[model samples]
Target: MSRASPAERDERLDPVRWHRPTRGTTLRLISVAVLLLTAAAVLWFKPATCTPLLTAPGPTASSTGKAAPQSSTQNQARDQTEGKPAARAIPSGSVGVPIRLADPTALSVVRPGNRVDLLRLESDKDRTTPVANAALVLEVTGADDPVLGGLLLALAPEEAKQAIATTGRGFAIVIRPS
Candidate 1:
């Protein structure tokens, strides 16, 4: 045969025919598959005792050895009976003795007359003193009764002073008229 040019020789040696995979390639693929199967079998068949990653601590006895006793129905009934009020007492007021006028709208009332200053006491520490130049209405019961007057007068000077000072201990029915 006559000698072919370099380009012709290259054309005759087809890349598709030269690059085909062989038996060695098939052996390599099989080896990889076997290795993967062996690893999976070892993981599945291995003897392992699985311990809990997180375990709760066991409960302990309370410091008080005895459990708290529950209240009985009978005990509750007895307590209710003992705490009940016997009766409600009525309230009274008299004139010139700082008779608290019943006025829901007014915060406090000043008794009319010389040295007649009935001040409504406020618990707020900032407003302990009566607000100056503020007008408030007084509500007073006009029913005449000497007993109420005597009762108010009978109170000790200190007690009377205290009663006049604040609204804490006074009868709830008696309120400064607004």
Candidate 2:
């Protein structure tokens, strides 16, 4: 063979440049894009068919309806057992006397037509006692009868009356005539 010309040698040694991408490379890139798109869709959108973990039950009838009658009966029995006697007021024809005060050693008198005040006083040991403060009124029982001397006495119902009457205005002090 004869020696090749310089131009021919240059043409043979030049590199071949491709204008379009390779089929395998294009397919791989497209597949990667598709995978990324599927992942994004899964993150952004949730399926409506999925059910919640917890659901509330529908309304039901009350459980306590049957016990009402028994509860009322129990309440009535409690009231009957705990009932106390009603306090009675001192009678009018009877005189009121202060019996026991906070201080047992002290003596105090509450005459008729006067007021008495009662207060609760507590001792050092936490025991409480009722103390009475009295006001006295002096009046003669009978003025016309010479046989019956004019005597300073407290007000009370007539001796013949069987029941005593309480005035109810002042503190209760029950006294018997001496």
Candidate 3:
């Protein structure tokens, strides 16, 4: 192939021509800018729910300086043992399982004494599978602060074992309609 003349080559190498935007470039740039702004707006205006429920120190009772309401299971345990202290976290035969949800905000609607269904968050598949159903909520902290949120559930010993086995993985709660 023949080389272009030096003058022609110089013109081709001009920075102005090299840096010029093509016809579609403006559209692409505007779209990207709009996307970024939209993302920022969503994050900024969205409810501030960032903290984990467990971040607060101490048991729920200590927070308000009141004795926690005893569940029927706890009462039964106390009765059976004749003045023995029942477990504070959960009823005698049940387990107190702590779980972190995949999306911390999802726990906002949960509350103590509510029955919730636990699901294992299958991140790879973008879907969750059931882990436990009708688990008793022992304590709840809505994720409105600054870290990953948590929930304390009172599950039967057997179901608790299943939930415990999946610890460190993401979990979510479903509040069943009464």
Worst 10 residues of 3 by lDDT: 50-59
lDDT of each: 0.37, 0.38, 0.69
Return whichever of 2 and 3 wins on lDDT: 3
Listed in order, each prediction's TM-score against the native is 0.17, 0.21, 0.46
- Screening candidate 3 with a backbone cut-off below 3 angstroms (N, C-alpha, C), the clashing residue pairs are 50-147, 51-145, 51-146, 51-147, 52-148, 52-149
A best-first ranking of the candidates according to their lDDT comes to 3, 2, 1
Distance from true location, Cα of 19 in model 1, Å: 6.1
All-Cα superposition RMSD per candidate: 29.1, 32.3, 18.7
Candidate 3's residue-wise lDDT over 1-178, tens digit each?
9999988887784555556787799889999999999999998896754423222223346457886543355443654488432223455567678887777776777766678999987756777778889887776654575155688887877787777776445887789876
Give me the overall lDDT of model 2. Answer: 0.38
lDDT of 2 by residue, 1-178 (tens): 9998988876784587456878998999999999999999999998865322211223334466543211223433443477621112233344433222333222224322344334344434453333333323233222234234222222243321211222222222323343
Which candidate achieves the best lDDT against the true structure?
3
> Model 2, stretches more than 4 Å misplaced?
1-19, 48-50, 56-178
